[model samples]
Target: MVSPQVTNLAIILVMMQVSKQVPFDNPDVLLGVRALYILSNLIILGIYLYIQGKINKKRDMTTLKYVEPAPVGSGEEPRPVTTTVMEYDKQQLRQLIKTQMMGVGMMGVMHLYFKYTNPLLIQSIIPLKSALEGNLVKIHLFGKPAVGDLQRPFKAPQGLFGMGQGAVKSDKASVENAEKNWRGGVKEE
Candidate 1:
């Protein structure tokens, strides 16, 4: 659909061109004047809406009335809010925003980070991380360590201990012995 401004612009250009081409004695100037008058009315309406729209912000009853009652008053009335309800609403808003930003209690990101990046920690970990990694490597076709994937196998140590030194010894072990080690059995000499 053609907008009012565009229509006004076209009328102005038409009038300018017509005025230049037609003599002052030409009868067709009346037609051009009529077009200019129509365009002026459109311009006036556009300006009225653009300038007065803020004060004219009337709530559309057709859209809002079915869902929520028109905030209980005309624009002139000062809507009163109870302090308790106000505070409760504020708290709810704060909680909603906090949870939205922080996520489902940070578990979404924390779990992913822990899963992907097996970085060092101070806690004592399993006793036989090496043996476990070795068994994974032994059985695995690529001979890569475990802790990553079956094919690529993670470079990160599966356990919290030895900074991956354990996976080295475990890799050389026979499959039966490796299996026992992986089950957390005692490492016999």
Candidate 2:
């Protein structure tokens, strides 16, 4: 499977080529792109809202435990997390919404403040696409069985180059080690 970074790069490249074909200098065309951007953001937000509704309705309360790896180069030990499936999914969904909002805010700055039109057109589609492709949507929205990679306490996403292990550790030894370290002040290597 192609990495998400590669897929995103390909999408951006194609969008850039398409952007070059559009006449951003034309006020009418620019207005249309701006409208498209707003509409796409609204659609993405609507999808997330729908997923939020689903999560609220189902409210799976299965307990989940994992060790969240510490930040790279921070010299901090991994921390244990204990949460219900419902809560974990909520946190995941909240993060997705937060990231989308941040992107929209930055894009608003770039397009409105910087008066950049091409990115408005390009970004108009990216978030919507991401929202549709997101794992939470696959499980909650599309009703895919959350087994394997979609399992609860979903594995941390691989880095762009697949350079590191997943940050969330569910294995018994890892969780026990993190719990011990957290409770007993054991220094993590």
Query: Model 2, stretches more than 4 Å misplaced?
Result: 164-166, 183-189
Residues 137-159 of candidate 2: C-alpha lDDT, one tens digit per residue: 99988899999888877777776
By lDDT, the best candidate is 2
Cα deviation of 25 in candidate 2 (Å)?
Answer: 1.6
Q: What are the per-residue Cα lDDT tens digits for candidate 1 across 54-94?
A: 21342212211001112333432221222332232233334
List the global CA lDDT of all models. Answer: 0.32, 0.87
In model 2, pairs of residues that clash are: none
Q: Highest TM-score: which candidate?
A: 2
What is the lDDT, from 0 to 100, of the residue 19 in candidate 1?
Answer: 47
Ten contiguous residues with the weakest lDDT in model 2: 158-167
